[model samples]
Target: MQIQDLLKRTDKLPNVPDVVRELIQLLNDPNAKYSDIAARVSHDQTISLKVLRIVNSAYFGLARKISSIDEATVLLGMDRLKTLVIASGFASSVTKVDGIDLPEFWTESFRVAELSQWFAKRTESVDADEAFTIGIVHNIGRLLLHLTAPDVAHDIQTRVSNRQASRFKAEQDLLGFTSQDAGKALMDMWHFPKALGFAVQQHKRPFADGDPDPLACVLNLACYLNACIRTEREIDLVREGLPMAVIEAAGLSPSIVYELDDAMAVSDGLGHLIH
Candidate 1:
């Protein structure tokens, strides 16, 4: 089936809030004021409470607690405040879907997001917050597929697990499009930044073109690193196992992957925001 057909049956998917939609519009607006953003967030008590909860969480490691939306905006800065708002808002909208492990899914997504931000900071062309946001949303199409077609999703997963086909190949065979295709369609429907949608579409094959999109490259590396972490692979192996072209594409050194692995080790429990 086409991506549009699946999206047309999105009754089980999360309904993005109006405030979240407005916040997303402001996401790419260079002229957006922090005061206005704070006011908007404060107006939505649900999002406001979640933002405060996340900012005050141990993940941020702030010295003192923040009590107000204005203070949150000031402390987080516009970029990060925007990231938090988008993350919390989108995350809060998600309802339970069948045939998926919500906690496990979010845990991986959060790790990838943190790693994406880390890679973005080191890459000259990528925006760290944008990378983080994309990382969180990269797998949403898979979730959507699970919601709309659990039987097909299950078969695809089983095919990959049984070594019958790669996940992408299985998706292409079964659904006529990869999750990335569905994800980009969803992002377009949500009116997210075009670059963000492009990054999601290209992440699995960041170097498909002669010159890679830096955000896509960063996200690809983040997913790679996150996989290594999940499998508990040795740092030396991770460094050696990664392709030299992939490392260069993200403008990172092999040594930093070790550092990131150690950092990720201590970054547990941060995925609470997803629940």
Candidate 2:
């Protein structure tokens, strides 16, 4: 459960393939050409098929069916196409864990992604697709923990269920680190953008002064809203001190937040989109 243990387990960490990594890099580039991006996506037939499937799925709400990677790129745009690829890669990669139920994990991930997209669209601070990707991968540290230290992962889950401790608090007590910390470390090593790495690292403590990036604040709000929807428990100390300043900055209200959660829960055919 120590940071050193996680560092040692890096070799065993699930990684996106080289092609997928290249695709991600292209997506992250601001000036990457559409034809070049399409070419990269089309090279991997499996990923190309998945891209087409997601584009035609309810998640995109496209008026026409997408039969090719080029058409999908045209319909979804570069950023959204990138997000879908990232989500598809992760979803396909983490289908099973020794101690984790894949379905339950994906259910929560889908909900979080949907809610994050909703909030992002409402706020306009970041793209909804980017928010969806962030929400889906925000807890990837938990997936990594299950692989590296199954016992510790079980202990953390038990505390969340029995003691009602927040997942972050539980991780801190049991593992001397939280999932956000682990996720940040892992993504940083993977060469993710600094803004995303910072968001994953500080999502639980969004309001702490001098956190320069506002995307972290948006991620924190998304996590809070996800937790609120999944559990009926009243807002505790952890929920109360979140960056309302950031929430206001994002142009969101408590009511709009609740509506987003509701819409995510009933997003038609969304259950089929995860796997």
Q: How many angstroms is residue 99 displaced in model 2 relative to the true structure, after the best TM-score fit?
A: 3.3
lDDT of 1: 0.81
Worst 10 residues of 2 by lDDT: 261-270
Please give the TM-score that candidate 1 achieves against the real structure.
0.91
Clashes of each: 0, 0
Give the TM-scores of the predictions, in the order they appear.
Answer: 0.91, 0.81
The true-versus-predicted C-alpha distance at residue 81 of model 1, in Å, is: 2.0
The positional error of residue 236 in candidate 2, measured at the CA in angstroms, is 16
TM-score winner: 1
Model 2 steric clash pairs = none
In order, candidate lDDTs are 0.81, 0.70
Model 2 spans > 4 angstroms off: 26-28, 57-65, 209-212, 232-243, 249-271
For model 2, residues 120-140, the per-residue Cα lDDT tens digits are: 777656756557767777888
Q: For every candidate structure, what is the RMSD over all alpha carbons to the true structure, in angstroms?
A: 2.2, 3.8
Displacement of residue 205 (Cα, Å) in model 1 is: 1.4
